[model samples]
Target: AVVSFTGVAVAVVSFTSIGVAVVSFSDGSVTVVSFSGVPVAVSFSRISVVAVSFNDIAVVVVSFASIGVAVVSFSDGSV
Candidate 1:
């Protein structure tokens, strides 16, 4: 996951093959996670809340609050 933010404020999280998350704002919060597997990328810009969860062969991205972004990618031997 990849998160990029450039502004008054910024936040970023990366989980390698797991995922990435980025947030930016007066105040921002970002979260990225890869569970039981490896996720790809979760991204956010000028965001407030970013959440993600991934398991074998799955990906998820979620955003919350005013401005937020989330991305997740995962792969296990099998789904």
Candidate 2:
């Protein structure tokens, strides 16, 4: 589904059978909330990509600005 709020286009997809949820933003950003019982992954422009695995609720958030990159991951919801 999609919703336009304040002139910004936001999109959200339900969790599929493959167990992947996608959320997209107008500012060239994409977020994945699930991966077959895995965690979340997010990608941003000019930045990098994040992939979380091997744990429950382990979310990965990646941001790229000025060619710089950042990645965050959690194992077992701690560290």
TM-score of each: 0.28, 0.36
In order, the Cα lDDT scores of the candidates are: 0.39, 0.47
Residue runs of model 1 more than 4 Å from their true location after superposition:
8-55, 62-64, 72-79
Off by over 4 Å in 2: 35-79
Q: What digit string (tens of lDDT, one per residue) describes model 2 on residues 9-57?
A: 4443333445354656777666766665644445444434455545434
Q: What clash count goes with each model?
A: 14, 1
Which number leads on TM-score? 2
Error of 2 at 50 (Å): 18
Cα lDDT for residue 61, candidate 2: 50
Clashes of 1: 14
Give the Cα error of residue 48 in candidate 2, in Å: 21
Give candidate 2's error at residue 49 in angstroms. 18
The root-mean-square deviation over C-alpha atoms between each candidate and the true structure, in angstroms, is: 7.8, 7.4
